[model samples]
Target: MAIEWKGIFPAFTTKFTAADELDLPLFGKNLQAQIAAGIDGVILGGSLGEASVITTAEKETLTKYAVEQVAGKIPVVMNIAEGATAEAIRQAKLAAAWGAKGLMLLPPMRYKSDERETAEYFKAVAASTELPIMIYNNPVDYKVEVTLAIFDQLQAYSNIQAVKESTRDVSNVTRMISRFGDRFSLLCGVDTLAMEEMILGANGWVGGLVCAFPAETVAIYKLTKAGRIAEALAIYRWFLPLLELDLHPKLVQYIKLAEQQAGLGSELVRAPRLALVGEERTRILKVIDSAIATRPVLPDYLSL
Candidate 1:
């Protein structure tokens, strides 16, 4: 089936056992929760999923695992973030071979390439694979902004179907809609600005917090799009604190912590990234606890 890049697509964090091994069963459980929550799709091996620390072989395994677990229920898009164009092409091919329905391709990792270099890198990968690609434009964390001019150069690739707009500028959503029209689907990648972008023109949300609160994420999208703005605003206001967690440098840890609180997954992270501790842990918990203590019950209107 052709995957629709037009709703909530959670960039899931990789689940690890205490020994730091891939916990495929735990991963499946979280994915099942996403399916039940009515998320539009799933993205594995993105930055939130510890892509830098994961091996290409592991990602291929994850792509296969997600495909099997989802069993064609929803599209599974694998993320490709490599330092070289050839490596990116190889990752894209590996994902396609392993049954991924789509690919979220990042710019050449490690080095900060100029716009021309970045466009070339994307073109090379797109030319090598038939899978639909969501070009991730996260300059804040990735140091690469796929600017409008760069996108203008890439619009010819029909396989380059979408843009994960995490430039942190809400106006970028409007700019893309104005320039590309229906040519490129815009996915809001910043959790904080998700509502704003969606209200403007984003076709979907490539989310982080959805891993923890999938239902609420989907509800927000559905409600807003259904012209139930007041209802969506209430949930968005309640969700704002947790959504802010996705914007942090240690978002993986924060999100894993949230996942544990929600009984969705473990907080165990790979080496070099430890569980939160000290005042940091206490500080984050204060916000989470308060939100939980007063968490709003979803109305029947959101049952969809």
Candidate 2:
């Protein structure tokens, strides 16, 4: 019930060049701005950062660059999800080499795997690195779910220090905390469920929309932590439409567009990932606009 971690840890968006290379300079600037805005840390290349489409080498390169830029000002957690134990291990080692402070690992998924396979995968990856690791449980999109027993089996892993529970089930978040208590930190993954998880006693949040609105996300976490329920709800309800976008398949596209509109990052995602356009674009804007109208005032970067 007592933990020092507070405020937002924005799942940072990646900046891309016109040709779609990672724009690390812009990324560094964004990270610095978030820290200045009182964010807790930066989550590099999570769902918001579109880690799935990027290459293995690209993940390593981006992870390396982010660590250097942040320069230990705050924590930097690298996403290390892949299809196999070998690849995850390789990436974890590289992230350690790259100076990452923590590792975020989603369940191993390329196909359906049984309990043994899932447990072993996490065990292997956990064995590979000493950096504090957070289990990224995003079953809806990844098509894999780790049961509570899996967490029970892995409690022996000291480095497996946190969890980004994206199951979108507040009960599961509460259940895990009830079972494990402070054994593992609970990180709310779905932005729509942030306040609920925080209210129920989650450790922190690993957010996607923070790519577009780090200050607002940080404010949400801070208010929740301070027990200012009405104030936090005011902000959360205002941003409900944007958080709803988290459920869509083209979330990264919309998130990047939000960043572009805010002048924080570019919308140029890698190939096989197209930008939101036409009717889709119009609908998303309407959602964002309605949320902005509900809010008292838009944050400076999100204005115009």
Candidate 3:
């Protein structure tokens, strides 16, 4: 199950029971929805998946479960957001053993590392596993920017194959293409920027809102790639408001709430992350409801 490094890859949310436990039944339903909608891959335990609060064992459980559930229809990628180099390596190996086909590697958590250190951390993790890696280059949230020079250093590792490009500057897509010439597959990590990045030649989208709006998300990606810009833009314009929810700090809860509205998941989150309340919940629900009310009938994008 080699990764194609192209198409819609959902940064899937981890479903939880009201008791704050893994809700595998709901999680499986969402995974099935994404698969049926034609996503290229599924990434578990990512930022939107609430990786920080999910224990290591729980991450492994998710990897094993996703691998079994997707069952080779698409790749299952586990996210590695460890604070320690050794722990990152350990998790990478465990993910591979758990049947994950790829990994989404984030910079060392908590401590912001310099260029050399960031490159070294990535190199160490890449070397620790045979699994293909997609570097999560999100300086806006992670604080450590994986600059081009760092990527130049990383080019030696063939398994460090792709990037979840979340720098928020759409120009970076052109910069990467101009510099690396596809040395690394670039996937738009920001949901709101997915259409822009894809048009700029990003290979795929690691979308957060796709957990709830899989069909619209996949249609936008397929439509963009098929040279149907106008059609893609139509849905993207309709999708913009819902997609903006991915940028919030409470993205896990926000997305899960969207999933609830979509009848795909629940809003239960782990400790330190309470469910949305007061004006926030009401406001977000309005956006979700609005989108649902006007949800477009998608074209047959798969035929493209």
Number of the predicted model whose TM-score against the real structure is largest: 3
Task: Give the poorly placed runs of model 2, Cα more than 4 Å off.
Answer: 1-7, 290-304
Give a tens-digit lDDT track for model 2, residues 1-304: 1112335777877678987787878887778778776776677767677777777677778787777776767777888778888988998888778777888888876867787889899999998878788888878878788789999988999888788888879988779978998888888888899999999999788777777777778777777777777877888887778887877888888887777666687778877888878998898877765655555552343211
lDDT of 1 by residue, 162-269 (tens): 999999999999898888898899999999999989999898899998998888899899988887889889999999999999988899999998888888998899
Worst 10 residues of 1 by lDDT: 295-304
Cα RMSD for predicted model 3? 0.8
Q: What's the TM-score of each model vs. the native?
A: 0.97, 0.92, 0.99
Best of the two (2, 3) by TM-score: 3
lDDT on C-alpha atoms for all candidate structures: 0.90, 0.78, 0.92
lDDT score at residue 163, model 3, on the 0-100 scale: 98
Residue 59, candidate 1: Cα error in Å is 1.3
lDDT of residue 114 for candidate 2: 81
Q: Highest lDDT among the candidates is held by which one?
A: 3
Candidate 1 collision pairs: none
> Which residue pairs does candidate 3 place in steric collision?
none
